[model samples]
Target: MENPLTPDALLAGVRRTRLVAIVRGNDGPAAGRAALAAMEEGFQYVEIALTTPGALDAISEVRASAPVGCFVGAGTVLTKQDVDNVAAAGGQFIVTPSLAPSIEEAAGRGIPVLAGALTPSEAYEAMNRGAAAVKLFPASIGGPGYLKALRDPFPDIPFIAVGGVGLDEAAGYWGAGAIAVGLGGPLFGDAGSGGDLAPMRERARRFVALATQYDGRAAAESLR
Candidate 1:
């Protein structure tokens, strides 16, 4: 089924995909093709880095052609102008490597922002500034253990783990309480070199399975 759902619904379903594939392919054709591949693997959320050539146009075209439930967003956004551009392109969300007040302004207009942060303080500030969810960039350096430590202190805040994350790492992060995972090379996996997508799809499937298991466990624990 081609979803037939709204962007808001699509964004929510992104938690299910547990895979926000970041495509940094420099042109529209490659970016679009890569996005389609992710969607084919059951990934509903994909991010196009603004640093990529024609990134906004890629977002627009991808949004128009994406499956009904696909949630297309822009990454590497640093300013309110970038946020505006994302909204203008019909992007479902805005993700930044760092938090900016302009991102907050955009979030006020009903666009979701995944403001990136490294420390707990930055995460708190970003959330307070109206970020829909916080992105823990360079998570590879921090690792799942880092996310687990953060959960110890800030369980109330929502976080999306990014950077250096692989499909195989999904279950551990979910166990640590990540709301979603933002992946660049691993999920999108070498779009320029035309990397095979089979691994990516299998990874996505693993995430979906893990999330379902976690949901069930959470429910069971809640009833106890």
Candidate 2:
């Protein structure tokens, strides 16, 4: 599963693991440390939010420090320039907060992207425009029920439930047919800002255990 060079391989791994750690912080070094900590506890994919101070530096630092198979990526990516910068920094993937030009830009560069999309129009558009997956942002608005409804129409599009996703909500997203759950504060807590890594690791362990129990996209479709 190292590198996950192709979209199918990358998203397949995501569907199986069912969790992605989103690291956002005020300090780059602190965020890097937190990302490494998450990887140590079984997180294969980690995204460092570009909103953090010196986020590219954090991605570079984590990408270098991480073990060979672990993939580090950049999130909140907004433009083609952001895509280029993250690729230069050794980020293996790009995650946008909305349907941005970066999706096609990243695709053209052979980089997979989790493009954020809210409404059904955006979701369909994101998929047709080369997004590796559609990120359901602020999923709490409609919760699992809304996701289930979306799946009914776009069963082929892989969905990554993001924004406001916590441990308790993780199972719901999985059952609703999300290929993965992208978590920020709930998973990182204050660790990215130099808070207790022990608690973060413990949370990671709990989330991983919970995620593995759900059958992800396949199970949801079968049940439908």
Which candidate number would show the highest TM-score if scored against the true structure?
Answer: 2
> lDDT value for candidate 1?
0.73
lDDT of 2 by residue, 103-222 (tens): 999988778889999999999999988998999998988999999999898999999999888877787888888888998998999888889899999988878777765654323222
Using lDDT as the measure, which candidate wins? Answer: 2
Global lDDT of each candidate: 0.73, 0.87
Stretches off by above 4 angstroms in model 1 are 1-11, 192-224
Lowest summed lDDT across 10 adjacent residues in model 1 is found at: 215-224
What stretches of model 2 exceed 4 Å from their correct place? 1-4, 215-224
How far residue 164's Cα lies from its native spot in candidate 2, in Å, is: 1.3
